[model samples]
Target: MKRKVLSIILAAALTGTMLAGCGSSAKQETPAVASDTGAPVSEQPAESSATQTGTSGKQTDGKNVPELTSEPLTITLWDISTEDPGKTTMEEAVQRFMADYPNITINQVHQQNDNYKQQLVVAMSSKQAPDMYIHWGGGPMAEYYKSGFVNDMTEMFNTYDHPDFIDAAVAQSTYDGKVLAIPFGGLSGCDIFYNKTIFAEVGVEVPETIDDLEAVCDKLIEAGYVPFALANGSKWTGSMYYMYLVARHSGNEEFDAAYTQEGSFTSDAFIWAGNKIQDWVKKGYFPDGVNSLSTDDGQDKALLYDNTCAMMLHGSWQVSGIRADNQEWYDENIGVFRFPEDSEAAAKGVPQDVEIGTAIGNGFSFNCWNADGSVDQTKLDACYVLATQYFNDDAYNQRRLDNGTIPSIKGFENTIDDANMKVVADIFFNASNVQLWYDQYLPASVTEVHKNCMTELFGLQKTPEEIGQEQDAAMKASLAE
Candidate 1:
């Protein structure tokens, strides 16, 4: 498939609305030394006007900062942000970066969410990877790093003085002790977001256990509400439940062992998770035709907005969309809660406080070398600068906050005024253990089995045992490959 390259001029026009919301601001102070987390020094150091040569062979200032090249260069940036806010934030950030470094041209490409991972893999294999791209840093990125398709950004991260990123956020992009990507938005994790009005009407408080959640669902159903709004057609949305259940049942150790091929994927915990999802389906907890609902056009959200559903389990990113749909409803009616723990797991000594999702945030990765194994030093340097300026720059970080995103950058949390966003951020900050999303944490082939089996399990076409066996077979196959 041919990739579409968007023009900078067209991008500017499309993002005018976002530009209006994210009005231009004065540049902020640069950090002196980089750390994964905590506040950095706010004072800017004085520098000589004359450029100095650095030992790394790059042109530098008196502070040893690499000077940008004057030669015209066009770099492509691939990201999965086809909607507003994210798209706009990215475009506006790029435009600003371009204005600062006139010689650098960015051809920003937006790919559909579902197509992004596969497309990136193909592009990398074909030696057509973009110079820089937004990616979920975990197993998939580690794969790319192993194949030598990703750049090690540790030096640049250190060179840029660390930028007040969260430790978990930085660790997500690090592979083999090398930072491979820049941490962008805030750390993300999945949780149950409920309609306060619906819960109030049903006289049910936020659930704290599997039984409580089921009781709440029953109440919602009895009160003529869809118990849960699930976009299982996307598969990954449904997988969240399974992932959480498995986490509750088995915890991270067993899951990691299976992922690493040290244990079997067809464990009791995996089977129980699959069975529970099927049980939920049989109990009418999910809406009719949930298997056909699409998460991509906000269809799942529509259920909550229309008052058809009482709750939905989703990631922190959902806050932005909900706020956009109805700010008042989001502020006054939305309530966030962690996914309740399974009683069986709790009885078995599994900690209820452990979260089932990852603390990793999304960020951009630079393609260090060309397909034929050639390095473009100038392009690499420019890519790092672009990534840093767009994500770590304080002004752009404010834009992220305004967009209802929890920034991975430190100290930006104080700027967050959105109550709904703050709730999500609190959950992220308080999570005892944040397990990476299964599809993103496991190998690609294993992820495929996970999603497919989840879909089948939800559809009631496969038993939990069958799904576990299928997943195990796929995992073994991937390991053999």
Candidate 2:
């Protein structure tokens, strides 16, 4: 969410949109500080810059405060968002940041997430990468860093006030020994957003197991309600169910194995889960015409808000959207619950795949373009300072929470206000087992193959055995590459 804001700044700077919406570009502040000689490098203090104030309160030794230059620097950044001009909380944060260091101007840019991904790949491949661009966590992140377009933030991690600020997020951003990007915050992806009024009228408690869930779905269907809001046409949205199953049935070990090796997707754990999903579809659990619904077209919202659909399984990020679209509807009816694990799986003491609470959203990075090696370290330092400080700042975290988001920063959990959301928070913080999103961990190519296998299974385009064999082949090809 914050990435959307930061990217707005980046885009505006790079494209020069000339929109009156952007506040005036902030001027650089020069606070005089001493160097080894009687000369002053810049007006900003090395330890406490015009923009970045030390959170430690006490400046300890070995904290190297590099000298800064007086030269004004502008770095282009990219982000994606649904917010209109100037109202974005992140845009507000950028405005506030400008107040501190007048010299460093961040031209925030914005784009649609899907479009940005397509555009960024082309731009980076052409060596026209922005100074900074927001990126997702997981496999793509690792791949992009490997492609040599991202900066490693390890040094910034050590220098920041809260060394642990990025620790939880690092789980997604770190790949094969390198930390490629800063975590904006963590996200919970396996929540089942439900309609409380429907549960009450159906006289059904929240389902505690897969059998229990199936029974409830039957009752809901009989009661003239859609049991689940699923948008299969959007493709990736359908992947959420697969991830939940993978988390609950196979647990992290299976998920991690599948991630580390493509062959794991063909294991019994995934095959059984795929077959079960098809079984559920035959039972008519998902909404009617879901196969044709686009995920981004607000189908999930319509199912929940318009059609009396009982549940929509998605990330915590959707909490705000549900509430925003229909608060009275949400307040009187909406609730969120975890997906039920199979009783057999649970009996074996198999862990529920609970998503980590307070996880960071995907993060953006400062990609400096030092064509002549003239990029100022101080400017880089300033970018790190802004990224680190602003991300952990209470104001930004509170804003995210107000918008129905869970923050990943330490001690930032109290920002949530919804009672239903509190349950999700509890599930996340106290979960015995937590796993990253399945698609998040796999290479895009392999992830797509699995999705195709799933589609074939759901549509009965392939037999169970055929699906298994296809999955095996997909894994083999991915590993071969």
Q: TM-scores of all models?
A: 0.85, 0.80
lDDT of each: 0.70, 0.61
After TM-score superposition, the amount by which residue 392's alpha carbon in candidate 2 deviates from its true location, in angstroms, is 3.5
lDDT of 2 by residue, 148-192 (tens): 566666555544443233245555556555555666544554578
What's the C-alpha lDDT at position 267 in model 1? 80
Best by lDDT: 1
lDDT of 1 by residue, 145-181 (tens): 6566677666655554335565567667677677777
Error of 1 at 61 (Å): 9.7
Once model 2 is optimally superposed onto the true structure by TM-score, how far is the C-alpha of residue 41 displaced, in angstroms?
32
Candidate 2: segments with Cα more than 4 A from true spot: 1-69, 82-87, 162-167, 356-358, 372-376, 450-457, 463-481
Query: In candidate 1, which residue ranges exceed 4 Å CA deviation?
Result: 1-64, 356-360, 370-374
Model 2 TM? 0.80
RMSD of each: 8.8, 10.6
